[model samples]
Target chain A: MKFKNFLYIIFLTTYYSFSQENNSSINGDFINNFQSYNDDPLIGAIAPEEKVLNNAYLNVIYTKNNFSIGLRYESYLNALMDFDSEFQGNGIPYRYITYTADGLEVTAGNYYEQFGSGLILRTYEDKGLGIDNAMDGIKLRLNPISGVYLKSFIGRSRTYFNYSEGIIRGVDMEMDINEMLRIENNGSYIFGSSIVSRFQEDNNPKFNLPQNVAAFSNRLNIMHSGFNYYIEYAYKFNDPVGSFSLESNNYAPGKALLSNLSYSKKGIGINIESHWIDHMEFRSERAKEKEFIINYIPTISKQHTYTLLALYPASTQMEGEFGVQADIFYKLKKGSLLGGKYGTKININFSKINAIKNGTSFLNDSLNIRSPFLSYDNDKLYFTDFNIEINKKLDKKTKINFIVSNQKYNKDILEGKTPGEYGTIQSTIGVVDISYKIKKGHTIRIESQALRSKPDPNATKKGDGHWVMLLSEYTISPNWFFSIQDMYNFGNYDQTQRLHYINATFGYIIGSNRFEIGYGKKRAGIFCVGGVCKEVPASNGLNINISSSF
Target chain B: MKRYLLFTILFFFLSQYIFSQEKLPNISVKNLNGKKVNIQDINNEGSPIVLNFWATWCKPCKLELNTIAEDYEDWQDETGVKIIAVSIDDSRSMSKVAPYINSVGWDYEIYLDPNRDLARSLGVSTVPHTFLLNEKKEIVWEHRGYIPGDEHKLLEKIESLVK
Candidate 1:
């Protein structure tokens, strides 16, 4: 079938379905983002090959009964400034048809699935980072009995516009014991297990590889009224990865353990989580870096929304890392001494990650290489964060939130930069947010933030020093909103490097459609989603975004 | 392969026109307490339901929920209704969900769709997406994104259903 003819068939079918005006529904959404770039040598904002770029996506879905079909059309005219150039053309990258009937569901084409905590398998998409690892294949889900769910799939992970060389097959089964037993109870218990295998023909003549690798995960969840606990363990067979030479073989089996416990009652909530993984980098194509990932290793850290605080995010070290995090939330009742007229809320969070102690005697070999890591040790810190925030309403028209945080970041291992280049970054951050209601439908919010970090003596490795930021947002009842924010690096050791990033945004919304336009300077940083990182280059320009759904 | 996918989609589009029904999908999601819930059973005691899909990182979604929370009591009194706020935050931010909800003190029933199965099933591509369901548990209306006064429009829809 010719490509043009295929598109014609799609359009014709869509038109016919719409013209019928029957019980069927055709719904779609479109998002168009256009940006004009400007070059600023000072901040290293280099002009792209194209001065202006547009990234647009359209999703259309038709559904009737237990049958549904959807397709996503993506176009990157000249590709966004920093997006991979391979996405410069227009294509239908995602298309799937699913049918669910008689307690069975089947999908063919493309789909996303996750097993356990995604320690073993996860296929997903993140449009902001232009990463879509969706599997193109057939999937089946069955609910043969009450409270029992079974799912299996066979497919190839997507890599850009093409599919990877590895063939993937997996099956998962989960059962809610309480529900299956037909017990009308307050507490529940669930158990799940998954097995996945991948196959790829070895093409490297110099090294032998495992043509087939399998992984298995077992999970358990127990929930009582206000308490919840979940635990999952995964193991992977030996798989050789990374650069390999004939002189030495680098192959290792992978294993991970993850657990989370939480209790929430009334106005108090507490959660604790820990994870340990070793030799757990699982990917479809071993040669592909930063892409074609097959499994997800989570980074146990708070996702900071503040600009300065987010500058140095912790990236999950897939090779070997042990981490733990705890969060506490408490709310004071209204009319209490410290609660004022409205209740006051307090949140405390702390997280730390460290390099696992290697099994091999490191006296002879340098520990810098990825091969030596096997066991976990608490002495070497990879990242640490302690933060506390308080939110209170002072009066009927005013509210305030204050936050303080201390952090330790190791850039060398996390970013794969030169070892000992910047050593580690130790910093403190403070934030104050205030919201005031001028009238019933009028409101304004102001945010002030400061970040101070210890600077390195080396000029080349010196980090951006003390920073301050202020943001203000004003909104009127329904249709209009405006915001202005600025961040300044005032204490940089090199005065010439100190710069300010100022941005202003305006938005208008009508029904299901929204339009936003912004002009600003975006600092260079790593934007991450689900532990996947993408480099966002520094740019100064005008950005226009419009999205509508029907 | 691409041609095959296109052909499959076309086949479904044509077939759905003849048999499509306006009932909500029975996709499963998890409540804030980690209990599995079927979207089809959200209609409690045959009451109209407001199904809102949101995320913690979405500014507009937060604003919409906050605005609705402030007036939820009056709205419920006027028309007996229930609201189910679904969060599509992936596993990356799922841990913070319970604490975040407590801090806001929203009384609405909340659920987590970590993998977005329900969102995809409902064709929701953006945050702050809302759906209004009749007493029959059928989706009657939906709107995406939110402005400050969207709650008013939502309340009106519920009132019509109540009548």
Candidate 2:
């Protein structure tokens, strides 16, 4: 491993030399201008890692006039971290050269694409999750007429550091009927429809999954004085697979139906969404595991950010579930008793999920498992969380926010590995966040929260109860901050279960760079980004962090 | 069989504990010496630190990092600071980190966290999940995701500890 790293460094040095020469000569004028500026050498760059097993990639973007090109050269040092270093040997992960002009766009090579809320088709990359499904091929967009747009693409799905074998072709058309009709009127409505399909030969004999799968979606947006509404519906056909089923003889194709509706005006906005999925598991390969999920289920819950409040973030079950979400935002005008001088804002959100009921005919079958694949009678996985937040500016130097939330979750299905043991779990979390600016250079924030969950069979211990948390952040101008947080497990089975974890941190900043050191006891939980999350471990240790940019 | 099941459960919990205890990745970075050095060695090296990731074409990244570069010296004087810039630039732009630093005259320590191995291990899904580690090499705090003016917030955290 060490020898390979040395060789890798030599290769990088040679490659860097080559690129430098190439860049210096290709864009002399641009480089000269960029160089003319007193670009400070002390500008921060990416932070240093404690270890460097596999070398990282170099990404470069150059743009001249209406043309722009991006190239990323990646190298995997060693498969020491969670990432697969082998990707480095797979060649450039992403390289796209494109040009845009006169309402027309063209791109060749690898690129990420999303269409109309991304319900039907969304080819995205989440490097953190080691997921990159960028389409490798060609894409074109043209707007011949105002309010009428056209987009088409022919490519293959991105696999692990490479493109898939199947061919994916798609075309999308969107028309703003109001604009097309040239109506200078209020309450305008626009409608659009799109179709995306994937074609691959069915080579697997055991499952005989459909090689050619097509899905379509339609959307409508309406606007009027103080109110706007948007809705979309999408559906996919049945495609049996060995992974989604226990036996080929009992294989069943899957489908999904989704819709979202919303309205907003001035200081108030409301949104409602619903989704029903039946075996809608789509994958690039039939044998892929949880890592190969191609589609996502939009969760319906307030994504808590605080340590204690976010202890249990909801994870969407892809196999099948019925879910709904509602959100409302309203602001009270300033000068009112409730609004205060600077105005106040209020936000409320609720979401729920449940299993879809199924027939009992297969109940006697010993082959069937009750937990992971529970056959529900109503097929409804009901979960709901309602949160209300009121924000008010107490004075010029202070602002306060008070929030309360009630949530119900299905622990048996949500966290349970089997079916018959499935049961619902409920929890409540309330928090108060207050920010006070002591002066121009000093600010302080205090946060207090309480979380309680009902006893379930899966509880860490019998009668597992409630938790309390307190956190404070003090900040001073230029580059100083201090924070301390504690979680007190006050309720539940064991009196000894009352665990207190506390942490304090200090940071210093020089320019765009920052360095911080901290010590504390931490708990274990899941950390999520963009609806996808990973489990984070608990640790009691000292930590150092450094970040900079240039 | 029963004993085996008990062992498997114990193993699962033990692995979880160890995995959670796993610290951030370490790098053997060269300080323009071309001689490799571990990142932990830089602690208490007597300079305020700056760590940033940049590519040739990340406009926002260049803009944010450069904006800080313009005023880095003043920040250093006010707070004893040292900055280290690590390039996520691949083989294509790997050479650019040096010249880019030189041409830009960014007097910060520079290294490479290529293939984003470190970034992934740190749960850095986006370009700027910045962190502030104290002189003890302990990660005091971190923030994931970034927008304009986020640097100011980061500066506040650093400034609070300077005194």
| Candidate with maximal TM-score | 1
- Each model's DockQ score: 0.36, 0.02
Report the lDDT tens digits of candidate 1 across residue range A1-550: 3554365456546755566455555666688999999999888898786899999987777765566777787888978876888877778878888888998999998899998778889887767888788999999999999989999999999877888888999999999998799888788899999999999988777777888889999999898887888888998887765345435555557778888888787788888998887767778766566687888877888777677667778888876788899988888888899977777888898999988776212211233333333356766788899999787768877878788999988877777789778767889999998888887657898999999999544424877788999999987756778999998888887899799999999998766678999999988878866556778899999999998765
TM-score of each: 0.91, 0.65
Fnat values, one per model, are 0.30, 0.00
lDDT of each: 0.79, 0.56
| Model 1: per-residue Cα lDDT at residue A462 | 70
Off by over 4 Å in 2: A1-59, A73-92, A127-130, A159-162, A243-253, A359-382, A420-422, A457-464, A490-498, A504-522, A539-550, B1-163
Model 1 docking tier (incorrect/acceptable/medium/high):
acceptable
Estimate how well candidate 1 is docked, as a DockQ score: 0.36
Q: Tell me model 1's lDDT, rounded to 2 decimals.
A: 0.79
- The sequence of per-residue lDDT tens digits that candidate 2 reaches over residues A1-550 is 2343243334333433455323210100000000001111222112224333333443433333344444444445442233444454424566665666786878787766555555556676554455677788899877788767788888887776766666777778877776678777765666778777777777665666777877677777665653445566666554444333454332343445566555554466666666665565556555555555555555555556565556666766656666677766666776888876766766677777776555211221233432233334354455667778676668866767688887776655566435445355567888887877776657788999998888656544333478899999887655677888888877846776567777788777554455667766555545654445665444455555554321
Give a tens-digit lDDT track for model 1, residues B1-163. 5666466555645554554345677578888645678777676688788999998666568767866877889888888888899999876667667767765678989999888877876767778899888887777778777655567778888999888
